[model samples]
Target: MTAPLILHYAPDNASLCVRLALEEMRLPYRAVLVDRAKGAQRLPAYLALNPNGLIPVLETPQGPLFETGAILLWLADTQGALMPAPHDPARAHALQWLIWLSNTLHPAQRMLFYPDQYTSGDTGALRATTRQRLITQFDLLENARYANWLDAVTPTAQACYLAPLLRWPALYGGPTDWFDLARWPRLSHFARRFEARPAARRAALAEGLGRTPFSAPTPCNPSEGSAI
Candidate 1:
């Protein structure tokens, strides 16, 4: 029998995206906690798997895969689900949004979460600016032509990836008063629908996310490991 994939993760981190996808696909995998409160990610042992010391590192037959987007894409392709097939015309649209989530929206959130990483001074101003940028990004996403995927009855990798991004702003980084899911009705609707899925419910339980994790997120009370 093929070895089950191993996912090194911390609760409520980007790894949650992968866990959601795994559950959606009903794949066999083991979850290993990385305790961020203990600085476990930066330790040499974890570094060997992901030199960047990121929260997630999936041990696959090919090798250890880091980066949440890459792992989600790999799972979609390998399992032949979650994303449009290679020859499908919709594949272009799917790839475009997936890359946007990884390169644009995710980094914008990171900047809001850790402004000090970008600037040594005036982190407050940095966060303030990032918050507005995130709003604009969300607005664009709300009206994107291909946004039908967000509410599809069958979950997609993009939906798995997006659900967590929608959740974090309300719970993490700086003041969340500026971030409201209801501001974008379409995205808000997507959140409510996505979180009700069996896959989402299972991932939420595993990570200690509340029942309405995506639509009405609360700070995680993970059974193990720290979210920070």
Candidate 2:
């Protein structure tokens, strides 16, 4: 039997994305907590796994894999599930949106969550601007021709990636009053449907994300390690 993959993760962090994907895929894995509250990620031992000290490093038979997007894509490709095969016509479109989640939406979220990192001054202004940008981005996603790719019935890496992105604004984005999932009807529907899945439920329980983790998130009450 193949050895279980090792996931180095912190509760309710980007690691949650990988955890959701793993559960959806029914892949065997072991979860090892990295206590972010203690700055364990910055220590040399964890740095050996991910030099950038990011959350969610998957220790594969090939080696340790970092970056949530790359890890998801690798899992999809290796397992031959959760994404379109390379020769399929839909593969290009799938790759496009996946990269958008990684390069575009995720960075905007980072700015909202940690405005001080993006600018030395006027973090409030930066957050306000990023909030608007996120709204515009969500609007574009709502109307995208490929919006069907985020199907609630069939889990995709994109869906796994997007669910957390959708959840974070409500919990971590400062001054979240301007944000409302209801504004984007399709995404709102997606959130409700996706969070109802068995895989999502298991992930929520493991990570201490309460019911309605995607549709209406609350701060995690993880049994171990802080989100920060």
What candidate 2 gets wrong by more than 4 Å, as runs, is: none
Quote model 2's TM-score. Answer: 0.97
Candidate 1 lDDT score relative to the true structure:
0.93
Using Cα atoms with residue i matched to residue i, what is each candidate's TM-score against the true structure? 0.98, 0.97
TM-score of 1: 0.98
As for candidate 2, its clashing pairs are: none
Against the hidden true structure, what lDDT does model 2 obtain?
Answer: 0.91
lDDT tens string, model 1, 1-228?
167899999999999999999999999999999989999999999999999998789999998999999999999999999999999999998999899999999999999998999999999999999999999999999988976797688899999899999999999887899988999999999999999999999999999999999999998989998899
**Range of the 10 consecutive residues with the lowest summed lDDT in candidate 1:** 145-154
The RMSD of every model to the true structure, in order and in angstroms, is 0.9, 1.1
Worst 10 residues of 2 by lDDT: 146-155
> What is the lDDT for 45 in model 1?
96
